[model samples]
Every structure is written in structure tokens, then in C-alpha cells.
Target: MKSVDATEFRVGGSDGWTVTTSFNYNQWAEKNRFQVGDSLLFDYDSGKDSVYQVNKEDYDKCHTEKPIETYKDGHTSIKLDETGTLYFISGNCGNCRKNEKMVVQVMACRGSCNSAASLGYLSCLGVVGAFVASLLL
Candidate 1:
């Protein structure tokens, strides 16, 4: 299980998941630097609001119908397992049309796995494996 104490972000902060204001989300994400090991927690009323993971094009278009993934449990946790551009929007059409969306640039973890390795990216487990292999040799 990923540690809740670690790099996790509560979407919308003190106001929870509801769009207090577009500026709230904008300011919340401004100072945050997301990494592969981090996660996002969305807390809201599922009936009126939903979270949609989408692509840039879809996000820009506010196309909430077809999403890369959908979460509507009110409290959702999405782990960042890869590094790239990640886009999320409100699945509720009106809320989305009003521009309730977020774009995050997920970056690779910088500490243990910072390298141009053959397989490209490695998780913390890979770092451990490398350490173990060194010990064996």
C-alpha cells in the first residue's frame, strides 16, 4: 500500500473536491510538483460530481462522456504510476463546461531512479533490486 503520509495531494484542499472556485484549484496546483509515486485524492459528493481522467484534447474540449478513467465514489484515490501530462476534469457536464478541470505534469522520481536506463523508468523496487544485486556481487 502506498503511504498516505507520503506524497499525496488532496484535491481542492480545505474545500474538498467541489469546485470552490476555478482559482482555488489553480492556486492549489501552482506550488505542487507531482512525481510518479504521488497520488491524488478527490473528495466530493458523487451524485453531483465525478472525476474524469482524460487526455489533453478531450480535456480542452470538456468532453466528459468518454474518459480514460472515471471515478465517482465521492472519495477517490488515483496513484501516479508514470511520468507525463495528466489531465482531469469534472464528469458532470455543466461543471465541466464551466471549466472545472486540472492539468498536472507528472515527473519521474528524482532520487533513486534518476537515470537513462534501458527499460526507461524504474520504481523504488528497482532501486532495491539494484542494491541487492550489488551486495550479491
Candidate 2:
């Protein structure tokens, strides 16, 4: 059964993903808690920018030569399918160097939510995801 807890987090909050001196993505990521089954929604202009899932090394160096995964659509929704650290950077190496990257640590599922998610109940996971995100906010 799906629990009504599955959540989709908007990357960079209301500002979305963009190159701005005032927006700090690392700070934004530090404020939130991510878990398996949750989703990350990246909103940006496909024409000019794209999302690239990279390793820690690439993320640190702002290397766009190779990406684990690439998303070019204006809106990209990536599911947190595992528990661990995930790194993301901008396809634009210049923008990434300017600190347009973020690292997400997906915690293991816990409590009843874990069982629900283990059973493939994404709805329940969504609810839990939302609740966790709210607490951090």
C-alpha cells in the first residue's frame, strides 16, 4: 500500500536552479534531509542550462566532460532510489565553478516508513518525505 508520504523537493527552493551570487545551493542542501524514495525536482531553462549527475571529484572540480546521468529538459525529476551521497553539477562548467552544485545525502528509510517503502508503497514514502522536509524548513 502506498503511504501518502512521498515527496518531491524543489531544488533551490522557489528560486529554482540558476546562477546567482545570492543563491547558495550548498546552504540550501544543508537545510534539508533527503531519504530513499524521495524525489528531487530541478527546474531550469533547458535552452541554456542542464542538470548533470556527477561524482564527488567531478563535482568538486566542476568537470562536465562526463556525467553519470544527464537531464536536458527544462524540468527534471530524479528519484532518490538509494541511500548515500549524490552529487549534482551544472552542465555549464563556468556556472558550476561558481558554486551551482549540490550534494545530497539520502538517509536510509526508518520506522514504519521503511517497511512501507520496502513494500513499494511510494505514496507513504512521499508523505514521510514531505514531513521530513517540513521539519528542516
Deviation of model 2 at 74, angstroms: 0.9
TM-score of each: 0.76, 0.80
CA-lDDT, candidates in order = 0.77, 0.84
Off by over 4 Å in 2: 1-4, 114-137
Q: Score candidate 2 by lDDT.
A: 0.84
- Kindly state the number of residue pairs that clash in model 1: 0
Tens-place lDDT per residue, model 2, 1-137, is: 32436579999888788898899988888888887778999999999899999999999899998899999998999999888999999998888988889999998754445454344444455888766644553
Backbone clashes for every candidate come to 0, 12
After superposition, the stretches of candidate 1 with alpha carbons farther than 4 Å from their true spots are 1-5, 113-132, 135-137
Q: Ten consecutive residues with minimal summed lDDT in candidate 2?
A: 114-123
- lDDT string, candidate 1, 23-137, tens digits: 5565567679888768999998988999999988999898976799999999999988888988899998778777678888888774644333422433344877766654553
